[model samples]
Target: MKKKNKKLEVRKPNQEVRLASNVYIILIISFYSMIGIMTLCSLMLLIGIIAFKTNNLPLFSQIKTVISTIMIIIVLMFLILYPIKNTIEPETKLEKDAFIFALNRLGLKSKCELEKLNGIIHNLKRDRLHFSSESDLYRIYLLLENGQMVDYLISLRDLKQLIKIGQKVKIRNSNLKLPISGWCSDHLSISVIDEEGKTFYKFESYEPFNNKTKLKGRKIVG
Candidate 1:
């Protein structure tokens, strides 16, 4: 039981980011749509009332005041509420923390520099529809060094990260301290920026490129 409990669960990081991004977009669209519908309905009602009471001086002033007050209230509500809504907590924060723990156990490479370099992608296979709910294609590939495949699976958010099979990649370094080493270990972290200036974050888990047959089966045919 202890052995089973200690097993580390590996999760794909880009998937979580994609899911969180989609959720954020959906929430924003829904909030704005509701606000628009409500505003339009209120405006129509106010306009109808003013049209009917055009000759009443007191009624016209009261109606105008009500509309102005409502407009101010809506503006204030957006000013107060939008920031709070947009400040939603990171959905993958826990996963990222857990990953840091696993990395601590993996041990830092004394001379192992994973931080920054330029390289090529020799074999890349991606599946967007492997799961019906996911927004981005699932990518699994390896970095190439002098035509030799790197032993570890490399993951990034977009295809632009590895556009052509022989295209060069410029990798930069990032560091995050996690609780595994007294919460102070600085692990190698990275994010990629393509030629088009779009960014893709480094994924959490890495897998051995051991299944040659499976890897070949996943390759895109020309």
Candidate 2:
């Protein structure tokens, strides 16, 4: 007797479905960003209008154009400045000074003194990368002793991931040995230790630098 053959079917992802998912994600993010900016501008404009109304200024009543101009300026300033203030303010003159002081203490040259300073991620396409989101944090990079550059993305959640490109990082011990006994047994490993013996900050545990603890730049030079 001849045996019956069963046909196996392969299911592939629908291209349309994939495209729709991507579009949904993009729309959601774009919508949120737009909402945030618009909300801020609207709030500022409302506040200006309220204050002008409460003041009962003669200019607002006699010169409607002047009131309109002032309102426009207020809205424009809020719309343009809010995002810039939130995203770029962290890297300010004070931060720069702190970074320089930290680097000098570690004996590493400032980025200005470096021969080449560029983004670690090609897709970033910016010499100075600004990370406003957690996902962007992985784009940092470093230079190695062998004249080769290494990326921080190798280990997504690893300690090295905390180091940003252009940020000075000091490596105290790169070849820490793991013993083959007790809890860490059965594996031969080399660990990288920070200058202060602290593990790299995980995204969940990361805290913005405050006056108490300053951010420093240090690069390892063999």
Candidate 3:
């Protein structure tokens, strides 16, 4: 008796629904960011008026109280400021969801070996590398264009499957994921990860990129 060869697949839910959810998420974030900005502006106006109405330079305690109040307001404003916010946000999750959605829409299903997966990652010219540590086990790279973007994923994990950078390849399977547009790394680096969520395989990228690809054509150092 022989064991059946199972094809490894990368599947996803309906894209239309995912995209609608992303749009709704972005709109909600925009609303909150707007509210934050307006609140910040009103606080600044109030501070300016209080400063302008100052009649006499009084006790040092009064100055300290005023400064403390300004600091408190500024800190509160930053709790909602999208730009410098360090906490996880709905918008941030939406970005990840959108990336995952695009990866599925691009039709990434691989029954091939891990070598082929590596090749796909090498050819795409991605501007960013998006990995999910939450639900899906995948690595997606992307590049933006015309308010749209292109991307791909990696889901291979066989010990014998290793491809060197710049290694020649004959690309087939248009659905294969690759990262081609991203900036090259300054140093040689290798990563070791659990194979098939069990055994580990160590791989290296020669001069691979080392930052998050910010939207609107900028690379923000991570």
Candidate 4:
């Protein structure tokens, strides 16, 4: 009986250990999958750029068509794969505390008080549906405290008629520390929450304002 009890205790921890390992593995895989897709898109973009610069007209023409097709596929995939409804998973107090701690360590200010402000969507433009653009698409000037203005680049698709100016929207997952330079800046994922609390994922542009708003929306910007 003593030996059996000891074996049961060991088995309990082993099960827990396996469960924890699986969670980490899933998170890692999700992170890497996102990165990989973005990287592949970047490579296609680089090839197009090199061909353009070298005056390889035939190569550029061929690649442009292929890249465009791949981008369409990616968009369709995202729409099909992602859940349609806004669902927030409930977190335990301990899990919530740990998440806050991790955010603090990442140099994010106001980690606990991060609130998404509703802004009127204006100056909307759709470039490549899947990638970044030279100019920030879905532009909005977020009203901030102390009369300061925070200009943001909203990056997402299907915005042609879905959003407009004068429409108040609530936003979530606002990150303040990331630089606004390229297409794949390390900004936090932001979701637009409507008045009814429906959350929709959208990309924000984090680059400085250049007067030109309309440009070819591609992966790389010069």
Candidate 4 residue-wise lDDT, 93-127, digit = tens: 22222322332343333211234454544344443
Clashing pairs in 2: 168-217, 168-218, 169-218
Model 1: how far residue 99 lies from native, Å: 21
Candidate 1 C-alpha lDDT tens digits along 1-222: 001112232345455544554544454445556667767876776666566655466866877867776787588657754663544322234433334333433442111223444455455555543444433443444463434454233333444444445444443333333221122212322233346544433433221112221211111222
Error of 2 at 2 (Å): 56
Candidate 1 minimal-lDDT segment of 10 residues: 208-217
How well does model 2 score by local distance difference test? 0.35
* Residue range 1-222, candidate 3, lDDT tens digits: 111222323245456547654553454456456677768786886577467644365667557757776787677665655443322122233333343343344443222212112222233232224654523223333222222333333333331144233332221111212211112222221232233322133332212223342211111222
Residue-by-residue lDDT tens digits, candidate 2, 1-222: 111222211134345434443433343345456658776866786676657654665655636745575678677766765664343222333323332233333343322111222222222112224434433233334554445664332224334444443443332211111111001111111123345654333211112222222223233334
Where model 4 places Cα greater than 4 Å from the true spot, the runs are: 1-116, 122-136, 144-148, 173-189, 195-197, 204-222
User: lDDT-based ranking, best first?
Assistant: 1, 4, 3, 2
**C-alpha lDDT of all candidate models, in order:** 0.41, 0.35, 0.36, 0.39
Per-prediction CA RMSD (Å): 19.5, 22.4, 17.1, 20.8
TM-score against native, each model: 0.29, 0.21, 0.30, 0.27
Which scores greater on TM-score, model 3 or model 4? 3
Report clashes for each candidate as comma-separated counts: 1, 3, 13, 7
TM-score quality measure for candidate 3: 0.30
* Candidate closer to the true structure by lDDT (higher is better), 1 or 3: 1
Summing lDDT over every window of 10 consecutive residues in candidate 4, give the lowest-scoring window.
1-10
Q: Pairs clashing in candidate 4? A: 118-169, 153-204, 153-205, 154-205, 155-203, 155-204, 180-206
